[model samples]
Target chain A: MDDKIKMKVQELLQSGKIKGFLGLRERHGQVGPYLFTDGDDLEGLVVGDRFKPGDSRYPLNKQLMKITRGDPSGCYGVLVRGCDERGLKTLFGSGQIKSEQVVPVGIACPQDLADACECLKPYPDERVAGEAAEPRSFATVAKVEAMELDERFRLWLAEFSKCIKCYGCRNICPMCYCSECTLENKDFGDIGSLPAENPVFHLTRAIHMAGRCIDCGLCNEVCPADIPLRTLYKKIADIVEEEFHCRPGYGSPETPPGLNIRGEELKH
Target chain B: MEYRTVLTTCTYCGCGCGLYLEVMDGRLVGTIPCKTNPVNEGKLCVKGWNVHEFVQSPKRLTRPLLRKNRELTPVSWDEALDFTAARLREIKEAHGSDSIAFLASAKVTNEENYLIQKFARAAVGTNNVDHCARL
Candidate 1:
């Protein structure tokens, strides 16, 4: 519910700077992603805070990818929180999109929301609204690390068993743009049958998340079975960071995803 | 450049999980679970996530097909229904009604499943009714 973003979108659309501005719209007591083509239609613009701060979140960057694919030539503006900026960077690194194609209206997430995500960077590099919040530690991953080996195995297996074979995690992911997904392969995945081959399915997705996942928590939020997929992906990203000194969504788009070395990380 | 998500119930099963179908330029693109719906509570099964694919699948059956000379050929609705009814009658007269098993599917609506059971028991005089989900 930031008015500054609304004014910025309105200005950009009226000035013909963008063909359309992708952001959240509040309509009829509901909030969801909306494309504002006209500058006048900025009354219901929001930053995913309907009830609680940053509660009603959607993958705006995914929507951006969808619309961009539909009209490849048109430049557009998009709403980007810290996580979304990271996703956009990852997408750019993967050659799925160009940074020039999108003008991100960056907004820093509130402290409460950052804590909820246990985010290391709650603010985007460039913020149009909201002050910077204290970055949070990846306590969720550490909590798992604190567990005994056998206990961790049992915990993960139990969590993975709850999967209803819902691809909500992949479908909502901003970084997932592959034409063919390995998770849906009929040969090895057994795509349709339930009681998913426990740790294999989840672990396969985790392996795929390395060097790609931006540590966004949409996978956890959208999961119907309450699986901590974000934790799994975060762990994978952390491992990649430890080994290669590379982190996704924070580096130049020239190198391979695993070899991406951010300027600051190189300094470290 | 019209892009919006239309909130609709997943047609895959009887669970009636609410999901938003992403419609870009009047075409169905993807499915996202409705976060506020009490039924699903922002969780979708694999079928629910992929409900949009069936809508635009190239292999989807638009017309009925009938076996002719060991090949499935396109047939009109009346011909297909009549052919099926005649075969059912012939089997029932030759064998017992229980020999003709009727299997239902979760893909179809509950009303269709109800009618299928009714037809199996009342019209066909058989209690050999089953559901695909049961298998």
Candidate 2:
């Protein structure tokens, strides 16, 4: 771990790239994210844990961009787990954040956390810490898929019944950066009403996450109901990968397939 | 600029996720889970994100008021508190202390709430105290 971190640091500093690295550092006994400047400390840099909701990697990355936007010619290093990398890709594709200013320091998540996330990729194209793991399929999605239409609907209702409208899932997601969200629009559903208009809220969110969700599981972690939200987005992400021939944030810096569909030549 | 965020916990209870008044200038511009917080790790629930709305709200009480002769009249804080104390005392004296129940607000601080309960139990001599969150 020490060697891997040192090599990355050396390369980052030597290449004259990145004004700073934003990631967790061990402060006394607790670990918290830090902004490491070249002359500052690197002794406590470590990568571990996949604590959802508590993890501010996504928001910190946004803060870095916000802070460094005026310095157009500057760059910074960001720690990206699989979900964060995917989020960065989607954000770049959507023009929410710039790619040039970001240097992804990738970290692969553990299997238990990956399973909880139902992630398709456990690592980014680069690795600065830990070995990558083969992506695993989630049985929860399969189980939901296998259910008959009514049975699925019933199950979903039962699960969604517990929704307290905390909005934890959307707030914690890296890919869910919107100046204004449609879910809150009164036309879609009643404001502050429980069970949220029978799947309108969740389904709308699922549809929005169609080509956007990075399977971070932050939503699931923050959800008070312990709803298996991962299944919903994972299934949609899988469909996006299969049908669109693309995964969110993985392709070249091109328009999303949904918007750039061409003439009938490409249509079935 | 004026904005408000409602002070509330993550609705995904058990975690008791605390979030803030995401005030921008004076308006609640956006949600930022308190960074210095220990519980939330600077993360907010979806509900916590918009917590500021209920504050600075057109619906929120801007001034104390009292209903007199079946009509609400805007009143001073002194008048409101005096009226409330007199009413409670009358109720306790007439119908017994148990008849005058005290329901506390979750939005208030622990000290405020403790003082209220103490006043109710010792002064008013009623244990009919409950809270929005029974903590």
Candidate 3:
């Protein structure tokens, strides 16, 4: 799988098809996102797996946006799994990054990663390696959905209480590109204060994440307090899907940012 | 065209949460938590996350400032250091060394912090050296 991805990247870089190939490289035993300009420098290129398959993943699309935000004309090849493809799609929908500027080198996620993520679609539209895994559902969201309103509130309060006001969830989000965040405003929850206002910070972000979050599970992974942030955002995604019939990232190559759900149609 | 993450320790506090500063085209772009670091275990506080912002902030202090006539005025490094030394001597002589405690910042390196405490203890003969991030 790694060899196939490497060869594809090599082809893209050597043929001058892409200005650079945005992917991961294993350096000093730590795999991280790197931009490969030279094809021969693909010595440590990887599919983000260090030990377990699909364990080590970075927000490559986020890096893509940061780099390409300055210059959008240059076409670059990016490594993407299902979740990353979704993030890129959402980013395209939001006009943060353009589809023309990017060529997604898609790789299907392994079943173990699929099952772990409880993903809806575990494969990208195009792929170089790995079989398309069976889609999964959000069990955590279902469990929360089954709870009573007050119980749910209390549970979220308990979860949110552990937040150290570390905007890891927001900072790490590929979709969050707002320069002037509402969270920073005085009207919103206390920004610097620890034990962030109950549900305010998370709820604000979750609301913003509506029709946006791609269920990367990065928030959950990076949270030091062990908050189930993805569950909250997943619930938001479910609402968006059920109500608007819109999924942010799932779209054909032609209609990349398929935001078919128009707010103008809402009667309420 | 050049993109790499330089592994470094967060200077915000002494917890020393390891992080990678993502540099793109010789510019600081963002920060990422080092996943393998035992200190943070892929976690960082708000300050650590936004550590790159202050580096490129327009409001950040670029030169030393000294209070002149109840107003801060930008001064040369030598002027600021000399003024600070003279004032320190006066304060130590008048009110004794304990009255002039040295406060160290977490934003500086450990070596700089050690210099501050040493300056307090040896020069001023005061053990009232304290750190902002002292536990």
Candidate 1 lDDT, tens digit per residue, A1-268? 3789988888888888789998877765556787888877788788887677777788888888888778777889999988888888878766677677789999999899999999988888987999889999889899999999999999999999988887888888887777778898887677778888889888988887878788779899899789999988999989998988887877655555447432211110
Colliding residue pairs in candidate 3: none
Cα error of candidate 2 at position A104, Å? 1.7
* TM score of chain A per candidate: 0.94, 0.82, 0.92
> What ordering of candidates by DockQ runs from best to worst?
3, 1, 2
Candidate with top lDDT is 1
What is the alpha-carbon lDDT for the whole of candidate 3? 0.82
Give the TM-score comparing model 3 with the true structure, all chains together. Answer: 0.89
Candidate 3 deviant stretches above 4 angstroms: A190-194, A253-268, B1-4
Tens digit of lDDT per residue, candidate 3, span A1-268?
A: 8899999998888888799888888777566777888887799888876677666777788889876765556889999999999988777666677788898999999898898899999889889988899999999888988999999999999989988888888877777777778888888866667778887888988998888788988888888889999889989998888876777788642332334322221111
RMSD of 3: 4.0
Residue A189 C-alpha lDDT in model 1 = 72
Instruction: Tell me how many residue pairs clash in candidate 2.
Output: 19
Better of 1 and 3 by DockQ: 3
Docking class of 2: incorrect
lDDT tens digits, residues B8-111, model 3?
A: 88988888888888997788989988766668877888889988888899999999999889999999999999998999999989999899988899878889
Best by DockQ: 3
Q: Relative to the unseen true structure, what is the C-alpha lDDT of residue A231 in candidate 3, on a scale of 0 to 100?
A: 89
Per model, the share of native interface contacts recovered reads 0.59, 0.20, 0.55
Q: Give the best candidate by TM-score.
A: 3
Clashes of each: 0, 19, 0
